[model samples]
Target: MDARQRLIETTRELLHERGYVGTSPRAVQERAGVGQGSMYHHFAGKADLARTALERTAALERERAEALLGDASVPPADRVVAYLRRERDALRGCPVGRHTQDPDVLADDGLRSPVEQTFAWLRQRIAGLLAQAQQEGSLRAEADPAAVAAAVAAVVQGGYVLARAAASPEPAAAAADGAVAMLEALRTPPRAPHRA
Candidate 1:
């Protein structure tokens, strides 16, 4: 890859692994195999490079989510389950979700914008799927789509945290499975006929 591309990709990985404070410009340059002059030639500084990388990460995240959740051919309820069960590296944690814990990234709008928008989009998409499930009678009419969606998001994010804290992927898997089970419970079962 080119210097600019290498810098961006390296920054994204570092940001995901080390958070803002942990990822130094020197580290980025060394990892990217680029000299200070090369990095400076491509971008203004760390903030500029980080902004570009974060935006790229968010876009990729949205595209992957939309592929599963936005698929019209799949049943809305199935789509929700598919997304929750999607394979991911739990120990590694979420690239975007991890940003919320970074004080530096949280303090800067330029750095935080992509992270904020990515989560907002994810929650909104889940809410839409739940709403569709309700409309189709797949989900219980009494369940609020927005609240359920928030819970679902929480389960996934919290799963990452659990996994990282335990230093094992099992907790994350269990969390996901539990979330799926809750969603299964939300399904409206056929009612038995009343005995007159």
Candidate 2:
């Protein structure tokens, strides 16, 4: 690979392993086998390289989520469950989530927009599903779909935090499983007609 590609690839790996705060350009250079002059020639500095790396991470995440949610022909609830259970070995938060938690990372608009947009798009996708469920008479009218969608998003995101803080992926996985189960159970069903 070329020096710029090597640098971006190394940056992605380091960012995922240690997050933005812990990753350094020198470390990336060492890992990528690229010299400082070469890396600088391609990227203005650490921030620029990191931002590009983050955008790549965001794009990857977007692709994954889109595959799960963008296929409108798929059943909504099934899509939700499938996304939650996607082949993740641990609840290491989404790459986008890890980036947003970084102070320096979030402070940059160029870097932060993709992260913000990912969640925003996910929430809307969930909301649309909930709306579809409601229109189909499979979800209760009493609950607001948008609010429920937001809660769903919150649980998944917060689950990552809880699991990471506990140093165990179980809590996060459990939270996701539990939320999905709850939503599934709460699905509306036809009531038996009352006999006179």
**Cα lDDT of all candidates, in order?**
0.91, 0.81
Candidate 2 residue 14 C-alpha distance from true site, Å = 1.4
The C-alpha stretches of model 1 lying farther than 4 A from their native spots are 191-196
**Model 1 error, position 129 (Å):** 0.9
lDDT of 2 by residue, 108-177 (tens): 8877877888888888888888788778787777768788778888877888888888889888889888
Q: Mind giving the per-residue lDDT tens digits that candidate 1 earns over 126-168? A: 9998999989988999988888888988998999999999999
Name the TM-score of candidate 2: 0.86
Best by TM-score: 1
Assess the local accuracy of residue 126 in candidate 1 as a C-alpha lDDT between 0 and 100: 92
- How good is model 1 by TM-score? 0.92
